[model samples]
Target: MGKNRLQLENHLFILPDYLNHPFISGNKLRKLKYNVLEAKKQKKETLLTFGGAYSNHIAAVAYAGKEYGFKTVGVIRGEELADSISQNPTLTFAQNCGMEFKFVSREQYRNKNNPLFLNQLKEAFHNIYVLPEGGTNALAVKGCEEILEEADAKFDYICCPVGTGGTISGLINSSFKHQKIIGFPALKGDFLNKEITKFAAKTNWELNLDYHFGGYAKVTDALIAFINTFKLQYNIPLDPIYTGKMMFGICDMIQKGYFDENAKILAVHTGGLQGIAGMNTVLKQQNKPLIV
Candidate 1:
């Protein structure tokens, strides 16, 4: 996925997959590449997906649909956000890309995977290609498999932020048996273990649960400070939701002597920078420092 590696520290390198595309960046691009092709093969006219107000997946899917000549539909969670779309950067961007929105309640969104609910959506939108929330599916994993090049095998460990487990699963499948794949989950729970095993063909990966920092989208002042400091120091923008926490944990582990001496580490910078504006909005309402 990357050849221009940025050295963050001694034996630590970052694969800036974010530079792949302006809108559909990083893992979002990897996860959608094959799915978009599949949708075209199916002769679909509309691409439908689900996400929250500030979802990176929603923003990416909208832009992808616009770029690929398909109508985009976002089944957004939280109906209350419907009227406030203008205030949300991600949603606004998606809307500007010609994405139609169907704001559903949290309870209704929970039924997103149910057969009846899916059937209802299928009935409502003809010739629609449905992408699951977080965009994790078999095809997504296949696309993610291309993230790590043969040259990446030189590293002892590969690290990435885990959302729906698709990216790490692909890395697990493609990585050398001698290389360890470490996933820093953005969400809390042991549920991802089972979810990841569904698509991953190998057992070379493990999740680090300690870095989620109070769970998905929940961040402390320290995390905000770290993100700002990291960008200031390295000129790499990280979203508060995923990559920021992963980097925080990685730095903490390095300081704690978690890695073997002289071991090389490669971290995948899965982009979600689109969410920064929305997150900073929340931070401001709470009177907290922003991720500059």
Candidate 2:
């Protein structure tokens, strides 16, 4: 599993996790590993989850559910996206993987966990195995706990992109006492402070909120330039949503002496590469340089 990996500037990096499998590569694979098994354990035949137009979670759940022989339902966040699924790359990919959709307005989507909303889904898809959006549940965190290994204990810091807090929380739980887990969140706000810790068991972790780059899916010219330059230098394509921002934060922190000069760092590339195509389309419309 240590494939497409490299070391740079005293830091070790690995491929987009989405590359591990044609379908479930990246963090999605790790997040779903135990959930898939639990679903099978219950003999569940349908997987229900939620996400937006370009959610890696949606695509991953679709592919994993299809491959593992479970029916997939993606309750997409934006109701407007339903009519234009063919134009949306992520949704198109999930649809191709046989994922059914239930488009909900942003307001309704926000209430995804409301007992009433969940009851509606339960009624629609009986005995379905429900996965929280971003696929971060206890079992998913269990899967992420395995992302680190015995050999990884040597690093002084373990960095990862945080979306729904599951991945970083898993790292927090499995991290060694000497290794601090630094999460570069893709979204603004301290909301994640509570969400991530709920599943974490360690105190050796922190969230660098300065690198969100104007909130989720929001990017600037400077960010695009960094992404382009990084890809050219490292020969690694990073999605703008998660890994790109995390890498930018790490480099900024490194330059600012945030880490010890000899600190060894490991960054998990969670694999939101699929969203690049969609992001590029938007960039082109905005007359911006594309992520190369």
Candidate 3:
């Protein structure tokens, strides 16, 4: 439960940051820490952010806003989700935290960053502090940079799951020159390289694109089995959306002899465990095995 690294096997370690908090743990905690501070510093009374129904960022922002005395609004992606909040654990938790919802169509949600679209949001929610989807702004990256400690310097490679590129960018900034930062992206795309370049100060990081299993939120039976087996073996739970895929890739790479002999690897466990219930719901509908 501490910040100590949990060694899974020889030379493979995990930073159990998911234990940082029961809710806003892992990279979500790191990503939100300074953003919340900046909102308070700006004297903002309301925090507005965007995310999918099962988004960890939305859940984190809602809890952080409640804990920090700010009203929260979540611009959820799927409009139909509004009526099904009771069925979705993540959205239900956010609502219980007093987070207001603004559900939009998938088409409209794509314009979430559009200037005119944002202006409409500004008009609707006055005096709001806006956080981007996945909460990967510069301030969030600043918070993520602190995830690595001096003790982590001994690691030859630092690894984490990449969402909107904030956490990995922070790792890239804080990593030693000799340490290679490896990212396993949860979403499929070649677009992340450019996104990471926007905030990362170093060129030491690289993304392993082979293990997404599919696009965002997509899962397969093999991934589910790996996640369940991994938890049974290591007693460490990894969320399907991000950490699970990243861990699967790292393990696959090790089996394929990707890492050099004696290479020290630190894999960061960025939490999204709250999404498990929702994911299990989807798996049940598909008659697939649950993550457990």
Candidate 4:
């Protein structure tokens, strides 16, 4: 992506979060930095994680685990995905990275954190380093806090897409009082406030809940069009699950006079471009325009 690609206005700067390694890019790398170390310290050889089908977290964790010499097991949410794993790009990538799958029904997945469910897993797989869904834990939050550097202090607004709240909570903690952290949630709900508040220690942040388009993993023609145009103009790839929605929300807010005219906003591109191929697969199945 060119430096001037995201020049929607003089006030906004887009940080291309996917320019790093093909795997472990953006906030995923930030969230995993500490967890991997702790797993090492604990002498864990197996990493067991949870995610829905086509989860970016799943792909990242699988790759990270492979690179770090750990046996990776993903407890996937949909049992139906078990037979179709070969067709799903995200799951296929994780599988190719040496991640084994334990697909359970949606009902069983609802109890993913239940003690009984965990005890059952303990019996099934010993020495497992468990990571929760979306990899949002205290260690993950601590890792996320390092995303902003000293040079980022000049920006008036720090923007990022909200997934499991760990990333935005980190942004909120690291941001200065004068620099408000703005999160555009990819899911439609006020429920994330409680999750974010669990780790956020500052008040210089708020959520724009109107930009989910539909809901988690949902997309509209307008959103698809916007994403396509954005890539064409910016030469940046954004996944539909997170960063795409945030960028749309930021642009819509700016257009609606939601921010101060002089406010300088830096949008953190929390990388999920890996999920785009899977997302486009879904779009094609639905007869929708593919994300260009």
Report the C-alpha lDDT of model 3 over 168-207, residue by residue, as the tens digit.
9999999988899999999999799999999999899899
lDDT per residue, candidate 1, 50-136, as tens digits?
999899999999999999999999999999999998999999999999999999999999999999999899899889999999999
User: Runs in model 3 with CA error above 4 Å?
Assistant: 1-3
Per-residue lDDT for 233 in model 1? Answer: 94
lDDT of all predictions, in order shown? 0.94, 0.88, 0.92, 0.88
RMSD of 2: 1.7
Which of the predicted structures, 1 or 4, would earn the higher TM-score when compared with the native?
1
Model 2, span 104-174: residue lDDT tens: 89888899889889999999989899999999989999999988878776778889999999999998999
Say which prediction, candidate 2 or candidate 3, comes out ahead on lDDT. Answer: 3
TM accuracy, model 2? 0.96
lDDT of 1: 0.94
Q: Which residue pairs overlap in candidate 3's backbone?
A: none
Please say which candidate is ahead in lDDT: 3 or 4. 3
Pairs that collide in candidate 4 are none
Cα RMSD (angstroms) for every candidate in the order listed: 1.0, 1.7, 1.3, 2.0
Clashes of each: 0, 4, 0, 0
Best by lDDT: 1
